[model samples]
Target chain A: MVLMFKIFKNGWLDIFAALKGYELAGVLGWQDIRQRYRRSSLGPFWLTISMGVLIGALGLVFGNLFASPMKEFLPFLTIGLILWTLITTAVNEGCTGFTAAEAMIKQISLPLFTHILRVLWRNLIIFAHNLVVFPLILLVFGVPLPATALLAIVGLVLLILNLSWMMLLLGVFCTRYRDVPQIITNLLQVCFYLTPIIWMPNLLPKRASILLLHANPFFHLIEIVRAPLLGTLPSALSWQVGIVLAIAGWVFTIIFYGRFRSRIAYWL
Target chain B: MTNILINNLCVEFPIYNSTTGRSLKNHLMQAVTGGLMGSNEQGHVVVKALHNICLDLKEGDRLGVLGHNGAGKSTLLRVISGVYAPIGGSIVVNGKVTSLIGLSLGMDSEATGIENIYLRGALLGFNRSWLSSKVKEIVDFAGIGDFIEMPLRTYSTGMQMRLAFSIATMQQPEILVMDEWLTVGDADFQEKAQQRLQEIISKTSILVIATHSPELVERVCNKMIRLERGALIAA
Candidate 1:
């Protein structure tokens, strides 16, 4: 019991110390984006442009195929894809958060949590860039701003909280097992189709939709934000699921992270 | 009052082979079979990097760690720097610690020299305001005229080292840890760097350095210990 207490204390302290280094994480995060597109004339707008093209192309093809009207379908698809990208990129990058900083990890003693924050921050920046397409989509599709849109901020905060834990857990695991990254990438690919990013969840009959969509944790995660941004309040189920997942995920992650946080440098 | 108290510290590395050792499949199979298949598959190898080491360093102590390659010198320094948590025993450190082990680890080649000052400085735990205050001094000490405005990749190796060395020594640490004496830049800069390094070492309350050079230990450190195959052999 004493050992467990010590682990929890150290884990919490690691996070608290890392929080003091947020400026370092933020700068490194911006550098990742800037370095990736250094020579390009358009710079990070390239992220905006590519995501815009994908949303435009997919919106037209999928909207016609599903026979959903363009007015509602485009905004739904836009928000869904944007949030999905944020989730997947954060997870994928998290797998390398420790391993990628092998030099810094071995040589210096920065808090391990700082690397996880860097991954999340980088993906968040990318998510912000991709979000630039949303306002443009709203303009083109003539979607009205709704008061429910403010709720998306709460959803976003919850989503970030959930992603942070996932990143910490995956970062520790992936550092130890080299093959875990490939497994994660493949699993996320499968999840992309399983989740309703491109398709409308309402397509299914009422009973089936409720069972399938409500059961999917990813659907709720995306819905909490996407639903609010699309001018409708998310169902209480979505908010409940989001809150429950955040708490449960953090609880599990803190224990796991605390248990193995010290061993991360050795694994790398 | 700055000190480092380590008691019977042990550090071990689990050396994982590519195929079976570090794979999720192997771990799952182990869970399923228990010890049935343990003999055939080569189990993970564990290398003892540091074994039952105890040391106490107080203020104004300059301790040199002398070891041959693979003798755990780097590992010991890492443990002292708080990078590697000892698998056994405890270490109580009562001072702010700074490591000069990898001076250029976080630097960005795509970033200009001035930007890298902030980048590397922040990685070393210096805040933006402090870094901003020292930017001009670091730039001047580095003496890479006008290169500060250009991307670091454009600078030659010596210029890069100069900038890295300057930024790394900007702060006075309570406990300073180093892997070796740094020899940076051309002869002129090397002389200047040596002087700056000596100044920092003198000001730091406790110094831990690992080096192969006995001459460096004799010239600088007040105490010295030698290690062989992860065990302390002499003091």
Candidate 2:
């Protein structure tokens, strides 16, 4: 019980301290984007352009193949792909949150959560860049702006909350076991197909769709944002799943982080 | 007032090599075989970086640490800086601490000298207003001139070090921890750098520096200790 209390304190306090360092994380995150796109004339817009090209091509082939109208299918596919990109990239990069910051971790005494925030914030910037494609897709397809679209912000907040905990957990775990990152990359690759990004969940029969969509947490995460933006309220089930995952994941992460927080620098 | 109270502090590092130590496969195999294969496998190696160390530092104290390579000098400094938490003991630190262990740790080579000033300063916990107020002074002291607008990668090694040194010493920390005495740039700049460093050290409440040069410790420190293989041997 005493050990549990210690772990709770260690994990939560690190997060509280890290919240105060958002400015540091923000600057570092922006620098990461700038550094990656340095000397390129298009800068980070290249993210939007490449994503735009992929969405366009996939929309063309898949829309025709699925025999859905371009107007209806394009917006759905666009939103799905954008949210999927955020989830996949965030998790992939999350695996390296501690290792990539090895220099800063070993030398400085900044809150360890600050590194996790840096990774999330960096991906959010890329997510924002990719979001540019969404507006264009809406404009071209003439998808009417729906009142439910504003809820995407709330959905995004929930999604970010969920991703943050995953990053924290994976960041600490991957630091100790070097092989986990590779395993995670391969798993996420498999998950991309398992989760509905390019394909529509409606394509499956009702029973199969329910089983696949409800059981897979990523589907609920994506649907929370994508559903609202694509002109429908997310099912009550999606919100319930998202909220539960956020709370549960954070509880587990806090305990895991507290137990292992002190060991991260050693692992690195 | 500034104080650093440490008691029976211990730090151990588990060195996980690539082969058997850091792989999930080995761990799973060990679990499957129970204790059967665990004995033969070369598990992770643990290095006791710091052991049963105790020290008390107060305001107006200048403590120098002397040791050869891998004698835990750097680890000791890091523990004080709050980078590595103690595994088996307790440490209570009051007052803000700044470490000049790696002056260029967070600097970005792709960024301009001016941009790196903010980046590195933010890592050191300075807010934007504070950094904005001191940007001109940092630039002037670094002496990079027109190159301040150019990317850091364009700067020569001495120029980069000078800029890093200037940004690192801009704030007067209550507890100043350093790995070594920073002497950088050409002869003229070295004189200026030393003067700046001395000025900061004099105003600092507590100074903890690790170095090999006995002459440096004699010149700068009033109290000194020596560590041999993670154990304090002399004081």
Give the alpha-carbon lDDT of every model: 0.88, 0.88
Judging by lDDT against the true structure, name the best candidate.
2
Minimal lDDT window, size 10, model 1 chain A: A203-212
Q: What DockQ results do all the predictions give, each relative to the true complex?
A: 0.73, 0.76
Q: Write the per-residue lDDT of candidate 2 for residues B1-235, one digit (tens) a residue.
A: 7899989988877646634444554464444211111212235545667788889999998999998787889999899988899977999999999998778888889899999999999999999999999999999998989999999999999999999999999988899998888889999999999999999999999999999999999999998999877778798
Q: Candidate 1 DockQ category? A: medium
Clashes of each: 0, 0
Query: What is the DockQ (computed on Cα atoms) for candidate 2?
Result: 0.76
Which run of 10 residues does model 1 chain B get worst, by summed lDDT?
A: B32-41
Q: What is the C-alpha RMSD of each candidate to the true structure, in Å?
A: 5.2, 5.2
**lDDT by residue for model 2 over A1-268, one digit each (tens)?**
8988889888999999999879999999999999999999999999999999999999989999988888888888888888988988898789899999999989998889999999999999999999999889989977777888999999999999999999899989999888998999898888888888878887888888876788989999999999889888999999999999999999999999999998899888
Worst 10 residues of 2 chain B by lDDT: B32-41
Chain A TM-score for each of the predictions: 0.97, 0.98
